[model samples]
Target: MVQPNPPVLEVSGLSMHFTSGRGKKKTTLKAVDQVSFSIGHAETFGLVGESGCGKTTCGRTIIRLYNPTAGKIMVKGRDLSGKLNKEERRFLTDNVAMIFQDPIESLNPRMTIEEIVGEGLTVKGKMNRAEVRRRVYETLDKVGLTQEHATRYPHEFSGGQRQRVGIARALINQPSLIIADEPVSALDVSIQAQVINLLNDLKRDLGLSILFIAHDLSVVKYFSDKIGVMYFGKMVELAEGEELYKNPMHPYTRSLLSAVPRPNPLTERFRVRVNYDPEAEHDYTSEQPRMAQLSPGHFVWCSPSEQQRYESMMRQ
Candidate 1:
């Protein structure tokens, strides 16, 4: 899951470990390791990486779906890292919502749009059936659907429409922070634009903070004010979107950016893809590596020597 935009929340040394097998065969996997970043109150923070980099895992961990092995998850001065009490649980449920990746899989085919979108209100028992129905229609309309569409099932809608339904469900709670996991990946190019535009409009009108996780650099750059690039459960680079694109410091980030196809035919032809093999890139034998600031709002995971080198490179 993602954040609202600015320092309303902070995650310090967050880690999630999964252990499997028995005895000698037992092994532990650190899906997220010492990952730390703060998200603002009403802005979009784009998280990008190749598959299996712990983007989704980190989000899930923050949302408390999986217990963290170690670290602190703080929101609005409340430490939410460990087990949550009833009040903390209520706070989490009220302020945060997630729109999952698969449009079809995320929604229950048996349930109508009204049922799915109004579930939050119904669960809290704060509204009657008529009120829930009215709120559901209003929420649905916010995402580009109409009151008449509320009775339709998931099977009755297109992929884009289904995604919009998912959005409405998340919005019905009037959440401050939304963790949208690859929300547009399953749709066609045209539909992706529509959904993204809807999100932008909603963000502007409602002042929402979003944690947007996706593989599309173009979309991430366009929609996010800040971007963090993750690699192998670590955030390799993070900065404002413009700074990240203007000057990517980390080798892995450079490698990732090199792969993005430029629109200009001349530049695209000349673009050199940087192949980043982590083992070959750096030697952590003599020194341990950690996240270090090369400049304000620009950070890189590096050892002391590497930080010096990066500082030198920036100067050059």
Candidate 2:
């Protein structure tokens, strides 16, 4: 199968590190190390990994919320690196938006829903009050919220409703790309489904591209066209959603898939267990783990021995 053209959001050699402690005792923690991937226009690219694996930091870095220690972030063919001039920054803001993890914490308690949704427009100063109100109502309706709900504070709504409000705020600007940083992680299971469905509907209706970041593989499988697995700040595997789940490469990806609960008791009982020796430390100086193409559009970054085994297996 032929792969598509260059993606709308192309990240190459993205790296982020932070220094901790003071003076002579300082140590650098490589939060995100040489991660690279791309999301096609109107595509949902999922990032799945355990907590503290730097998935969130990767998302923030892609949007330039945190300056990358090294690497390039290209959105719609525009480089968003270094300090931007005022006009350039404004243009970037209008083009990209983020849906934070916690809607309650992200939304202001003092502000009304209308004010919160209109905040982006107010800051951009591109539309008048009447125009902003019209756009806000239109966005609210698009996310399944009513104009009446707009007058109330965020606290007035339930968790799912609050999330809808957050989505409305992100969509009000008509951004081409959105980074949904675990948008449904905080909600109840039922509410989670509702929010996911709402996001799907919005994505289809608005023709927006998204990076859906979450640890839940099942959710990622349902929502994403392509999935990338991160481990210890490095992207170890990336493939189509079904292909990755059906034939996972890399030890870490296999281990993650093994943990996903099976519906059948027999299958669950027979599932393979992954054992990683905690005493064994990660070695980063070796070769930088170049990605080996397993098949069309499927890639894995593994050691030479593992890559040989995987290649042999695929040939069979």
Candidate 3:
């Protein structure tokens, strides 16, 4: 069932750096540095990291919300940097959709559900009003929304219902890939499960390629087929979701895994968090670290010596 032919989303050496302050006081902050990865067709690739580590920036940049300072972003083998005609540009927008973190802020409060979800349909001029209405109602139904809710404004719905509208909006275009940036992070715990399950079901039914971004490792592991762990604007580790959890080679990755809360009361009470201090943990002065593959699908960002250290640890 693993189709590794063409990647739905591919990014290479992507970097986004910003400068703050004025003149002499200006300091350059590298938000995303030389990140590279690809999501195969229908595969859910999870990007997990702490806040300000550039996970959201990466997602936005991929969707062309923020232009990249360097590197390439290819959607379905078409490079965005190339001269895109009207059709190609339209193709890009239609194929790639994003589910924002905060549903309330993402959805226009003034717009009714029908207008919001059917917004994408406006881009392609083929559908008539009746057809658009039918499509909207059907799509709303797909997201567990009733047709009766279409006339209501965003403010009328609960948090979870608002998110369903967002998802409906994204799916209206029949996008080949979806970048869900902390989609469930803002919802209540019970509501979060409902949204997560909805996404899971949609992926199964629609064969969606999802770039699921989140700060929670447990959620990432549950939803992702593969995962890439970010640290200080760099991809420190990438592997199969279960593989990464079972065998976290990078110090930062191991530290993150240690922090994921366990269900058992005894385990939670005695769990010790492994802190990660970049300065103390790595000495990149001599030779800069790069992403090195330890196994077929496992990659860790480390110097040559550190790579060997991880390999040795895996052997034991």
Candidate 4:
């Protein structure tokens, strides 16, 4: 039997809660509530949800942009949740990179593409100017930008070109795990395809594990090997991309999938939107729900009774 490669990213019971006000007036918002998932080497794990579902917050927390209130984050076998030592900090910087959502907002207006892309290497203080420039050119070339474009400022380039510059910056570090928070959401449809294809090629060539966060399930389904659907602050459903599309067990997941527009006119005319009401569909007053394995590689957050109902539905 062939053994599988170890997971590149592992998160368990991750939570990020924001607190406001003082004393009796304090209120806590659970931005990410006990979320857990894993990403395999060279695989894409898509986190899909509606707006304000904590998808972006989850991605930010994993990369230590925000200190997690609860849970453990193990990236490349190193614990990243707790306080970091110098080496741990170095490890995080060297092995992980992030691609932000807004292309224009992410890039600095004053900096040329060369300066922006090479900043990571320059900050390391290890590579000299010549080395950084050379690497920046090579990285730009990898992302389909020519050396000539490197001298131009962000304002000089189109939206797509600017996004490519962002991608080049992320690639400059040669990271193993990339947390892409809606990397293509801001681009035009044509531009989105180009960027996604570039990312696919890079993932194949570099064997990089990607945590892709997006609100569009159709986009996630196309790019992800595994898909996890989040609702509000919890992961409601998770399975292989195709599996989740074919068999969405949770009411919230079903509602989300039902909203995806169809290409065919006939299908579009007949598409019925599913409205999900948690309070109406679930009787959680008696028993609390938890993430349970309903089948191989499939999990749903539900109580025992709900699991039984889902299992029966799957059988049919």
The lDDT leader among the candidates is 3
Candidate 3: misplaced stretches above 4 Å? 1-4, 82-85
For model 4 the TM-score comes to: 0.97
Q: Quote each prediction's TM-score.
A: 0.96, 0.93, 0.96, 0.97
Residues 30-116 of candidate 2 have per-residue lDDT tens digits of: 999988888888999999999999999999987788889998887777777777788777777877899999989999999999999
Task: Provide the clashing-pair count of each candidate structure.
Answer: 10, 0, 0, 0
- Deviation in angstroms for 212 in model 3? 0.4
Candidate 3 residues 288-314, lDDT tens each?
Answer: 899999999999999999999999999
Clashing pairs in 1: 1-59, 2-211, 4-43, 4-209, 5-40, 5-43, 6-39, 6-40, 6-41, 7-40
The 10 consecutive residues of candidate 3 with the worst lDDT sum are 1-10
Which residue ranges in model 1 land beyond 4 Å of their true spot? Answer: 1-6
Inter-residue clash pairs, candidate 4? none
Model 2 per-residue lDDT at 77: 74
Error of 1 at 174 (Å): 0.8
Q: All candidates' lDDT scores?
A: 0.90, 0.87, 0.92, 0.91
Winning candidate number (TM-score): 4
lDDT of 4 at 204: 93
Ranking, TM-score, top scorer first: 4, 1, 3, 2
Better of 1 and 4 by lDDT: 4
| Distance from true location, Cα of 113 in model 2, Å | 0.5
lDDT of 1 at 10: 81
